[model samples]
Target: MYIPQLSNQKAFDSFILIDGVLHFFQFTIGSKHAINRGLVGVGEKYGFPKDMAKWHFTFVMPPNRVLKVPQAHQGPLKDSKLYSAILDVGVEIPVE
Candidate 1:
């Protein structure tokens, strides 16, 4: 389930939550146009005492040009070469 794109429904939706149900996330709520945003962080962690399915979460944001920070691990190579290796390997990965 998604956070519904808000139009004039903010008042009613204000207290709604992702609830950590299905072990999902807690995200900052905001307007659809990216104005008047608010910070909402929940540190509650969910564990799989029995069912392991809750540990996975997949999110797909709308497409846009992305500028990303260097990854936590740069691997065993220099930036240019490593970037090329990653790109070559990633090229054939399917999106869907």
Candidate 2:
């Protein structure tokens, strides 16, 4: 299942549940980034448990975009086991 951000002010770009894990995704076209701690905060703000093992965070960016995690953000991101993927041209995500 997938849920898109309904408002521009929302923290995450979308949400997807795959294989029972809830994934929070933030898509960026430029250098803007979302830290893992912020993503976890979003889940907690929405009433999800802080320690939920199945909650994941994903950073989706264009192909060839370098992901630079600032030193300050490395710890929480590593602890959270952040996930990422590239969205290149011609890739299609079918919407039903």
Candidate 3:
């Protein structure tokens, strides 16, 4: 899986899967104050609640066959950028 990353970014650097939706957090200078606030749970590791609106992409359930997101703790979709990216990847539907 070739996930896009910024300069020297790791797999789980600036992103988190909250409730099955993968969110990309693009932090800016103005966001410094908000980032300072305490982030609770796994969502904080990626800087949520503040940068929640800056999410880059969102894929609906069944993100693709190659990757499986455990359906455990999920939240509401706040915002999104490109749906085309999700379609271009061709996610596989799981078998029931």
Candidate 4:
């Protein structure tokens, strides 16, 4: 299901129920550039049921940088620490 461009102009993706668990995958929605707040907004609007334990949500992390740099310029684009952590561990861990 999807929410129209209501007052917020943000789009909600889908909600699926499997094995009694409500799963929601949401993308950009609010000022936070994440879905955490968006989930809460929709939840309140829907008057979600009491099966809190059966609810699951995954939010997308927004990109932090976008720029045009010279070809010779090369001074630590993004954060090396974050890149290192991802390599050390794995993508399974949420970067956000």
Give the TM-scores of the predictions, in the order they appear: 0.19, 0.59, 0.25, 0.35
Q: Which is superior by TM-score, 1 or 3?
A: 3
Highest-scoring model, lDDT = 2
By TM-score rank, best first, the candidates go 2, 4, 3, 1
* Candidate 3 Cα errors over 4 Å, as ranges: 1-41, 58-76, 86-96
**Candidate closest to the true structure, highest TM-score:** 2
TM-score of candidate 4 relative to the true fold: 0.35
lDDT per prediction?
0.25, 0.62, 0.36, 0.41
Please identify model 2 stretches exceeding 4 Å from their true place. 2-5, 18-20, 36-42, 71-78, 90-96
lDDT: worst 10-residue window of model 1:
77-86
Candidate 4 residues lying further than 4 Å off, grouped into runs, are 1-11, 29-49, 62-96
Residue 56 lDDT, candidate 1, scale 0-100: 27
What tens digits encode model 1's per-residue C-alpha lDDT throughout 1-96?
Answer: 435377454312222223432323222222122211111112133132223222222222223222232321332211111011011322232333
- Put down candidate 2 lDDT per residue, 1-96, tens digits, no spaces: 456546674567777766767777877665656554566566666765455556676788776667754424344344454667898877654432
**Candidate 2 versus the native: TM-score?**
0.59
lDDT of 2 at 70: 42
What tens digits encode model 3's per-residue C-alpha lDDT throughout 1-96? Answer: 224456754222255556645564432212111121122344566445544444444223333323332221334333334331223335454444
lDDT, candidate 1, at 68: 31
